[model samples]
Target: MQSQPHVPGFTIRLADAEGGQEQEGAPKATRGFRRRRRNRHGRGLRGELMLPNLPGFRSRSERFDDMVLDSAERLQDMWGKQLDGVLFAVDEIPPNLEQLVAEGTAAPMGSCTPGGRGEAPMVTVYRRVVEQTATGREELQDLVHDVVVEYTAEMLGVPPETLDPVYRRRYQ
Candidate 1:
């Protein structure tokens, strides 16, 4: 019989059909068996190696950041030069209780800071609040886009409908 390939800390043994051992070396079979056994119970060496390659592996905060950036890019396409001085940002959540109390709300989805004296205006989207408010993936995308549009419109001193003709279409 052909011998099995050698692995670290493993030895292969071949046996006759009668279940008698033909050759034995260092209990090598146990190494492979150990690996299989570990994986069967939970994540093991194999899972560690493959985890980084799996789709949708980014953390929740990272995914939220991606959504914010993507929403900004789409708005940039629509606004062009008008968006040149706007700085887009994402925070896990808004700052302390002061701001929440000031707004008279339990959650604030986004905020805008008008720049002064050579500084660019900044728009901050609250990741955790927006994410928690969304019911699903498509809703999340729409909500993020809405927040961006609203903040940009406020920065430009225009209404959201003026910024995008199709802003918030329900049936379309």
Candidate 2:
């Protein structure tokens, strides 16, 4: 029957059978009535607003990767044996950006590295540079494809137009 200390916004109640006092004014939550952790403000769970099947469900980087893959696949079909061991990659920025800037050259959209010492030829697209150059999603996709085509052409020692007919048409 001992009285507990006063707690603001709560009324101390008699001890229950478990020998623990209750706070009468405090919210009582049952197992089934417990508040949701993510939906505290009555909104639904914080998850993807768009369905997985929707185009917007994918992130910008993921969409960019898909664009690169699509371009690579298209090129692969055209040059199967030649592109066999060539690796395609995406990087946020080019490594030699500082040097390029020091030399007063524009940042390259992509780079081509020829294989030597049993290494594979690699084509790397600078994602940030390419994204900055394009105005819209369609433009981004086209630019990504063009960058891939240009680097692939460089790796194979051919002009971009020879690698992809659309490459010449885009500039004209």
Candidate 3:
């Protein structure tokens, strides 16, 4: 007798009729078994099973949103109360700026808005632009951190290096 590997949820038995070898003149009808597929649920052409959504399965936009939030959190930790009044936002694209448009300035990965009339200062990061510019995941992460640092610096009227001392070291 030959050994068969154990398979979970399935049972196997040897056929004593032919002893796992084809007969020289076996009938074609007895070669294989045919049965219509059926289940407790409705049945027709029951195709491949669809997998349920699992944890860690995030959409592209959702992942980008998380990256933006994470960068903001890192900045808040670094700058402390200095970032309390600033609002961080992530959008698919940057808003059209009439002045910049008239000047023919290209689209930016991020932009900082100064507040007025009871509004708080805002930092806006453009998701599509940044994602398109990065060559890979690591590059995307670095670019995102750089954009956030740049925007925070702009909001605080300081240079990017001053915002985070280790900022330039990340790229190197």
Candidate 4:
């Protein structure tokens, strides 16, 4: 390396022969490399995700929408009628529900049982439990589906296949 005589009190800048930040002798593809692409839903697609609403879960995607459906839809599809609208406990869930909530807080799932005569069945769904259990929307959806199907069937005292299969077909 040749050391040019230093000019006193002068700041010197060196420019790379190649473009900025490229490794030495790196092959240059076209300057017009693709940046990225976003669909109407604002979700980015690299190759083959097949997801519709990329940025947000809700949108025109059938899969995403199905994931968001309430447990009522599961019962309605299975039994051919919507079970009374889904109700969750505003108060804290019982100990039994805590275990289930540990499974998923975002999609916490549970059911209410009858307190006594004139008291409605308390199909309790623990939101905190579900949230704690879930990692993301997809996981939450799956957790909700599994918990709802299992809990509802248990409350009705029927085999899962007896009710679950019917609704699974309808929703699918």
Candidate 5:
């Protein structure tokens, strides 16, 4: 039982019959020529668990953005030049939500801000609120489209039904 030199942060193990010293319970050293992969627990090389084209690959916020863009494109096809300078956006929640709740007003699902001082008209939907209000994916898509249409209509000074023929059709 020959004693080994003490190292500050590592435990030294005695040389085995192969005549190479190793750290206690440590993996054997590999040759530099051996390629290392990011495999874990003998699983294959690390990569996306789901394909990029899969629905699960996209985040909720990204999917929400897509819904907004889809609705915007549909509206753009209809309104074209009128929607040219309008901006569509999404926020996690409405600002001053606590104040609105304290004042007995529900947090807004969306808002329409009229353009002024060279700023473009903006429509914003509160993502969390709208998502919570919807029960399923199809419902969420419809709700998001309706919210965008509603705000766009407000900005254009027209009723939502007049702006989009399909507005509120789900409820009817």
Candidate 6:
């Protein structure tokens, strides 16, 4: 048995016939380059964070975050399957969402990687900025819709005559 110098929780061990990841009597390896799969609803080991208690109170920040995520997903759902049909740019352009999925980046947006680009152009609502600007969820939703619609309209090369009436009123 050989151990490397000054490295924590790393060791080389003989493989077992059963092929278990753990080596009998060997110290467990620390987390290395890994890509964990998050379950649907965005919950998984990677979700193990102590979020601020919203308990009965959906604070402006929480609402903003939820709405931004929901709207972003919906935008993609409405158009992403078509490939490059909709462009979703966050504060800045995110890397290829398809590639991020393959590479295992859980929250690519948070990582500052643009969400999508191709078809209709999209402007992502920044959670931090939206929350800062909004007084509640309803407000945040409007803001996100406004930004998206505006960006989409620009890409459409139209005067937004086709935009949802609600968004037109809320944003314009």
| Candidate 4 residue 152 C-alpha distance from true site, Å | 1.1
Order by lDDT, highest first: 5, 2, 3, 1, 4, 6
Better of 1 and 2 by lDDT: 2
lDDT scores for all predictions? 0.68, 0.73, 0.68, 0.47, 0.75, 0.45
Taking all chains together, each candidate's TM-score versus the true structure is 0.64, 0.67, 0.62, 0.42, 0.71, 0.38
Over 4 Å off, model 6? 1-66, 72-84, 92-122, 170-172
- lDDT tens digits, residues 1-172, model 5? 1111332222212112222337699997774222455454676556667787887877798788778877887787677667776677778888899999899988899888888897667788889999999999999999999999999999999999888998988876
Candidate 1 stretches greater than 4 Å from native: 1-53, 98-104
The candidate with the higher TM-score, 2 or 3, is: 2
Off by over 4 Å in 2: 1-50
Model 1 clashes, total count? 1
Candidate 1 lDDT over 1-172, as tens digits, reads 1111332222222112222334656453455442364666666555444365676555676676667667666666666667765677776667785777787978778888888886667788888788889899889888888898898788889999888777788327
Question: What lDDT is reached at residue 158 by model 1?
Answer: 96
Clashes of 3: 0
Q: Residue 7, candidate 2: how far off, in angstroms?
A: 74
Clash pairs, candidate 2, are none
- Count clashes in each candidate, considering only residues at least 3 apart in sequence or on different chains: 1, 0, 0, 15, 0, 8
Question: Which candidate comes out best when scored by TM-score?
Answer: 5
lDDT of 5: 0.75
lDDT of 4 at 3: 15
lDDT of 3 at 63: 74
Q: Pick the candidate with the highest lDDT.
A: 5
